[model samples]
Target: MKYDFIVVGHGLAGAILAETLRSRGSKVLVIDEPKENSASRVAAGLLNPVAGKRFAKSWLADAFIPAANAFYEALEARYGQQLFFHKPIYKIFSSIEEQNTWMAKSAGDNWGDYILATHTQSINQPGIDDPFGGIMIGRGGFLHVYALLDLLTEDLLKQELYLPERFDMDELQLTESGVKYKSIAADQLIFCEGYQVVHNPYFKWLPIQPTKGEVLEVQAEQNFSPECIYNKAVYVVPEGAGRFIIGATYDWRNPDEEPTPQGQEELSERFRQITSKQFKVTGHWAGIRPAVRDRRPLAGTHPKYKQLSVFNGMGSKGVLMAPYLAQRFAAALAGEEEVMPEIHIFRYLSLYYAYTDQQNQQP
Candidate 1:
């Protein structure tokens, strides 16, 4: 095989992993099929560590956030493109209890430098509906995920390391050495096909519960500063040029990327709940997130085939976690380190066994 590894899908996870491997001197070929509703393309790409109604910090936030910033910074330096932003996020307190919790956490210096400013009263931003006040979190921001993907795709194409085609499983042939797909052979193949992995015969048992989400790009009457992100029930991210990204509505039952009226209404209402700003709905888009049952990434080699592997299930925290996890996975693939056990594929080995057993019983 001419390629050391072949990566399927060019979304956020796949692109990062391929780049990590290439940086470590591995010959990589990335095959991608363009999906209009790719989550990475439409993602708001927040880098926030503080999350949820509970106002608790994200898991490994202190570690992952810095890794992501450094990774994106390196990419920007190489590509000469601004792919990352270091905007402060203002999380509006929903109730007194949440505000008090922040107070307690702040007293313990739990947030470190990530906490920029805490207002006992409203942050005093115009049009904001923060009656209880808000917390400005620093050392975090958002990633230009779409831009990063485009830059990587262009680079791959220039180097003849990228193939633009849909992966057809029927054409795949596993061998004693590795595997071949449509005459292209590699030492190993990793699948990062996102929510579509359910259709992959080899990875059928991966517990990826696809969740459909919709986001709206609204044109605010007053331009929101790109230096800050506002969060309430949902997040309102400034995209420069008076455009803001208001999202997202989560639907697990239908994992397709079809934008609906209900989603638009829900997003619009949620934005209203955070502020009294009127904005024109400029764009509406949707994508399916490859959220796992346990809310963690899925990595490591296949149980039955050493030549096959998967690197996906980024879920909602892709922007914050992908870079760190990608490097970790690359090291694991090279046998230089062990993959995070909590997210290793072996965790779901029983699911694969049960699936195979059912198939055998049917015959």
Candidate 2:
């Protein structure tokens, strides 16, 4: 029951961290309750190089994209499962102004490499009308998140490295030697609980503005190539055969992980705008993204507990952000290198510590 590291949660963050640690010859134990609705499980796994309406290249897209692609490719080779797919994204422009904005941005130094100034291009898909036209952004695709998670879980189970239960905080004992959970003793315990980190007493003080997102699985009668992900207001990602994953409505006020009627209605309307073909709703689900106030991931050790750390707050870009940051975190944990200053949780320590200090300083 002893381990070098104890990882809480089995979402992408924790799963990737555990795999990284194990790959480095560390004895790692992953404790998770599959019942919890993790953002990773519900995510469409889209890794878009360009983000937002302005078509801004994603944060650290240059570094993170290559690392993520390499990592997923290696995983696919090791597990004999297709984990990542490299495809283009067809972003439909709404107006002439929008197209102009995209053209200007695409010409800029930052987005020049990823973005291209092109008119609507025909692909092997249902005939959908593009009024203002669309542009294709290269080096984007979807990860088979569910498939990857299943493969990781099965592999971990075969290796007898996973604990299928809710991790109890009360049972955890911290000492001078190390931390103990049940019969296991670890030098450190990292919590990658995603949005659920809001409930963690140690790291909850960090400004984690969790956002609830809802997505739908639709079966389309019209054939669309899975080679590209189409984006309008909502993304229509082909999920093999005659089905596509349509999503998602970002609700900042509502923190519930349960899909709402309003969310479904909004998403359906968006889909209707992009495609005229009929589609059947096959499934609907929701997940709360581990969004932060500044929208940057929070990663570092606990303020009071030295052996405790966190690697959450990837937000909606977990597919692009997780692997690279997880590698950085694992390296930091293994005493190999320092985590980047900007993304490190130490950047927010002053705010979090000041809040905790104010509470303790209260009369």
Candidate 3:
């Protein structure tokens, strides 16, 4: 079989990349191991404009927010499935100082349209604490990640564009014009394997700090508002009916995606602090995020193997970053544009050189 591009891993990065390339009239074949636990699978799909304890605007929120919104909206229309939710994020202010800081920032045009409002009605309900009030961040919400992936999977399968198998690097042959995996040929091979990129020899020199995250699915005693994503020490987003997703715990040392008792307890305690509502823990999930050292996405083609490229390391912000970056990467592959410098693999060229030099020096 021959193709314009052979994409490995059907996770968020790979899915978006393949779709983008296909939209541009390229022949694409996706290779993936179907049951693998991936960050995208377990992600809450939150696309917040502001994050962290400091409540500062997220990186490139202005660019990412609009791009993601439009991209997901188009996909929803194309797929005929409701995927994107334009819910506001109500960030509960922990202190008067925090409130003051938000007041000052909201007064400026720094965040532009992303900041919907400085304050909202307190979530006046029992077991929920919010005396300090909260801020409403607009144009952000969750993407029904798995729903989109499954829709894409079905479409690809029907089109005979998907190969549901694990990709083995050993069987791959780098050819003069492209690459050959087994009997399949392609103009280029793009790796979007997420954290599994650690095992890929070609681009492992890039610093990818994979972090483990755990989240819980709980059935709250009361049905929370479906309009906004409420956050305090933990986030309790309405997942329809009486269920809410309470998560997530981040751990750098752990590599495996197996949920831990400690992770559950931590999330449970945090969930309790935010809301006094009784709930039953229905499900627990964990996955590794493909984080990078500089906290930016790692993209672009390989240094030596020009026909090989990567589109990984969007990390926890994959929902926000993937659409825009994938479009850029697909354009770069089509010889229409250049991958941005900061996220491009060239940023780590020195590391690749150092690694090759060390390899050549070895006996």
Best by TM-score: 1
User: TM-score, each model?
Assistant: 0.97, 0.94, 0.95
Ranking by TM-score: 1, 3, 2
Candidate number with greatest lDDT: 1
lDDT tens digits, residue span 140-196, model 2: 889988888889998889999888998898999998867999888998899988888
**172-286 in candidate 3: lDDT tens per residue?**
9999989999999999999998888888999889899879989899987764456688887777777898888877887989889899999999999988767767889999999
List lDDT for all candidates, in order: 0.88, 0.83, 0.85
| Native-referenced Cα lDDT, model 3 | 0.85
Q: What is the C-alpha RMSD of each candidate to the true structure, in Å?
A: 1.4, 2.0, 1.7
Question: Model 3, residue 298: what's the lDDT?
Answer: 86
Predicted candidate 1 versus true structure: per-residue lDDT over 1-363, tens digit per residue? 368999999999999999989999999999898776799999999888876765678888877987898899999999888988888889888888889988887786567777888987986677888999989988777888899998999999999999999988898889898989887889999999999999998998999998999999999878345568988888888889889998788899988889999999999998888878778999999999999998889998999899999999988788899889998999999998888997898999999999889888995
Off by over 4 Å in 3: 120-126
Q: Would you list the clashing residue pairs of candidate 1?
A: none
